[model samples]
Target chain A: DAGITQSPRHKVTETGTPVTLRCHQTENHRYMYWYRQDPGHGLRLIHYSYGVKDTDKGEVSDGYSVSRSKTEDFLLTLESATSSQTSVYFCAIRGDSFQETQYFGPGTRLLVL
Target chain B: AQTVTQSQPEMSVQEAETVTLSCTYDTSENNYYLFWYKQPPSRQMILVIRQEAYKQQNATENRFSVNFQKAAKSFSLKISDSQLGDTAMYFCAFGQVAGGGAQKLVFGQGTRLTINP
Candidate 1:
């Protein structure tokens, strides 16, 4: 898990409501990413942030948004959650040194009813 | 765009045996990275090994090694002297440096590996 921790590890929410997942890191890595894992799909990127206040979309960014206000916190929000959006979300961070590789958090399991 | 494929969905082997998991990727970019991730029942994504495209030498991590064929665009993981703790779902991933130098990863469907006693 490195220094990463995801809040609300398990969440049960209703469709059409809003949901936000938090990823906090203590090492202050320069890069952070959000991904979702599902059966037969392994894991797909949802969004990533290169630095504080700098963010971009990923392969499966639809229906989801991200915010990186501080270097330590990255948030992923489902403005209008749908049943199809139910999956386990993971957060990862890249070390500042030579393509060191990304370390992941424990992950958050979100179920939309 | 890059895509990673792990052809084997599941594999079973006895402890101390050797096994290989196949992974093929499609990508036009020459500068990239290849990785193998292991996820056990605990669901923790652990980094197994990685290979850089620019490097000609294959990557090895103790009991784990990779057979990377750059021309064929294939990267396979081989495990020797397997142990029961090695049983897990293994994912192959392709990585590229995105805008602002962020490395983005695309993963395969995953291969469930079981090491029997």
Candidate 2:
């Protein structure tokens, strides 16, 4: 285990509301990623952070944002929640180079009504 | 853009039997990595096996192994002596290293594997 945890394991929010999910890791990994899992789409990357204050957009970055102010914490925010954003969000950390395994935390299940 | 495809949406195998899951990926980059991740009912993604494109020999982990056919763009996972614990949603992923050592993964839709005991 890489000591990873995602807060608010399950959440329910109404449409147009603001919601933020948090991912905390104790491994001090330099790379952290956020992905959303849907029935037919599998897991699509939402956003990722390489280091403190450095982040980049992923394949499905629309309607989502991410910030990493510290090495241990990475946050994903949905500025205005929508029904399409309802899915399981997973957070993963890569401590080393490309060959290393990316450790994933228990996913956060979010439902937008 | 890189794409990973898993044609089989569901598969079943008897306990102690061997089963293989298929995965194919399309990528122009020569240097990359392929992986198989298992997501059990707990919803935690566990790495089953990984293969580096540069390696000619297949990679194996315990009862799990991968058949990497680079020319055919196919990566398949073989599980020997399957157990009930192996029942889970298996996902195939492709990772490409970008600038600054940031590697991003593209995953397949997943295959639901059931091990009947």
Candidate 3:
């Protein structure tokens, strides 16, 4: 447990509406990541940040955007929510360079109507 | 490009039994990492074990150990003394440095394991 938390453990939104998920970490880690877990596909990275204001796209970054204004918070935004985008999103942090072990948050389950 | 495959979609075993989950990957990179993650009903992703491609010896943690065959491109997790607490969805992933130096991962489909009483 690296003191990571995700906001709105559960959320329901209508298609075409905007949605944003927040990932907060008290670990003060240099690296932060956002991933979406879908049945049969396991988990896929949506986006990641190496530092404040430094973000990069992931394998599945088409419909998602991320912003890191400070070291403590990273936000993932879906400009327009879609039913296909419904999935459980997880936040993670990497503490050191020696170990590749990334600690994860509880996860946020989003449902689109 | 890299891909990880977990052939077993589900498995069940009696408590205190031993269980092995299969995982295979395709990669051309010389340096990379393999990992097993457990997701319980609570939906928390927990790292069970990790294996470095360059390491010759398999990695283990307590009751969990990995059979890492680099030449075969296989990494399997064997859980000894399985308990009800081990019931969860297990996922295997392949990782390497991406274009931006951030670790990128490709995960397997996942295996649902159940520990029976």
Candidate 4:
């Protein structure tokens, strides 16, 4: 509903392989975030960008990297996939307003063998 | 660090009944915000309700409302006239009021709700 889309809705790959997940937003919000959801752990932020080329690490930023070259595109990359990295990834965007509600994407389910 | 805790992992409510989901958070900041998000079997996350810490009155949206106790540091969601479609996983989140007016949310593990026919 927020015009947010996450590409590669489902991905299965082997360990040590490289993988990338993309999140595209048509709203052109000022903030974008990447999160991983796992059973019992809920959703944890991995990386976030406030503007193009302005990014920051989150609570669980290890082994993952992100890039936001433009306002509409945010990408998450796994340099070398690991089994522990398997989870459902979600992308969210929020306006520049204070505590504005965030809009989420459908999510991408990734599995590492 | 701020933390949100959802005590109930699984809960069930009969159709047309009312149910309350409990959420407690730990934060030292006086100015902040709380939110409730719902994720159904479709796995699409949806916002249910929100409450500002500075507000004394709770927030309500249709059949959904929040009992925000700032002193108690608790924010709970109550759903009235629950329906089968209400079944989903609910998450409670906290966000600090940033100086620049940008809010970044910290979320809880979540509670799975099942509405029985």
Candidate 5:
């Protein structure tokens, strides 16, 4: 199994507060992605990084930002938490090879009130 | 733009039985990749199977197999001898061919599968 860990497995914050979720991978994968899962909707991509300092927005990039300063670490931050942002977030890593399957982290559940 | 569709919102199967999950996608690109991911109650997403549009033969992984029909834009997953561990939310995803450095996965709504013991 790929070594991937998500810090703060569960969090509860008030609206308008700042929240940060961290994803650390022991496998030096070139591709890292952040996604949110909600009921009735599948996992929606929020942000992804191809390499250190190289990041891009995904389908649901609003209200979220990401950074990757090192190959093993990827961080997702919510500038200001909102009730709508409450959901389960997952981090995935994949190799540079085409058609490679992604390995996912356990996931972080966030609740905003 | 590419989109994945899973018509069945929920399904149930008896243990030791065979069950098939449906997935259909819309894409203009001739070459791409399709994947099935299983998210168990633990919320860990695991890859079940994958199919490349360029490949004519379907892809199978142990108890999981996929029926890939490129012309019809359909890719469905079949699970043989289902077990209680198979209960989870299944998502069908589509990804573009690897040319660009960044490839984002587009996912379907997801189908909840319950395996009865």
Candidate 6:
């Protein structure tokens, strides 16, 4: 809840549809991350950005893509939503210091049928 | 890749008592950070405590404290004077702090804790 907000907190979509989740931060932190939370998997990183226009893939980034055109906004996109992609997504941001703790947003619950 | 493990899937504690949650991690990096996060029923991820690998002193935040043993690769969270509101899912996470301080966290499966009054 650290001045971060995720759009479409709840969404129900159909398979094969495109879905995008937006994370906006007022903290102006240097790091932003996208993660998915499932029953067995507590949280898995999907994508992350270190700076504006700089992005990288994470352990579970295969089916996801991300973009950060600006420092305050990081976007995660599912090109073709699948049932497996249904889960609660979380966005987190960290300050520009090594000792800074990461803060999370509320979360977005995506359901695909 | 660094991996965090929270062995306890669930735990229970009575009000005003104490409970300890165990977490172990694997990391070859010498400089890193370990964190304990609490997720309430509302599903908000809140930071309970944090310890730096280089810091020999254990980290404490009010009733929450951590015992960090770098040699044992262990980091455990101890909650003193437990309250009903402490009932929640707790997750252990690890991250590497780069030169720019950019961080990416790797989390554990989480331990669900129930505090009964």
Per-model TM against the reference: 0.99, 0.99, 0.97, 0.97, 0.96, 0.97
> What TM-score does each model's chain B reach against the true chain B?
0.99, 0.98, 0.98, 0.95, 0.96, 0.96
- Per-residue CA lDDT of model 5 for B73-108, tens digit only, reads 999999999999999999999987432466678899
Q: Which pairs clash in the backbone of model 5?
A: none
Give the CA lDDT, 0 to 100, for residue B101 in model 1.
88
Cα lDDT of model 1 by residue, A15-65, tens digit: 999999999999889999999999999999999999999999999999999
Model 3 residue runs over 4 Å out of place are: none
True contacts kept of each: 0.67, 0.72, 0.65, 0.57, 0.80, 0.74
Regarding TM-score, does 1 or 3 come out ahead?
Answer: 1
Clashing pairs in 3: none
DockQ of 3: 0.68
Q: Using lDDT as the measure, what is the rank order of every candidate, best first? A: 1, 2, 6, 4, 3, 5
**lDDT score at residue A69, model 1, on the 0-100 scale:** 95
Interface RMSD of each: 1.0, 1.0, 1.6, 2.1, 1.9, 1.9
Model 3 residue A95 lDDT?
Answer: 60
User: lDDT: which candidate is best?
Assistant: 1
Q: How high is the lDDT of residue A60 in model 6? A: 96
Q: Rate the local accuracy (lDDT) of all candidates.
A: 0.96, 0.94, 0.92, 0.92, 0.91, 0.93
By TM-score, is 4 or 5 better? 4
Tens-digit lDDT string for candidate 2 (A3-28): 99999999999999999999999998
For model 4, the TM-score of its B chain against the native B chain is: 0.95
Model 1 TM-score relative to the real fold = 0.99
Off by over 4 Å in 6: B98-101
Error of 4 at B63 (Å): 0.2
DockQ of each: 0.79, 0.79, 0.68, 0.60, 0.70, 0.70
Selected candidate, larger DockQ, 1 vs 4: 1
Instruction: Put down candidate 4 lDDT per residue, B14-74, tens digits, no spaces.
Output: 9999999999999999988899999999999999999989999999999999999998998
Off by over 4 Å in 1: none
Q: After superposition, how far is residue A9 of candidate 4 from its true place, in Å?
A: 0.3
Between candidates 1 and 2, the one scoring higher on lDDT is 1
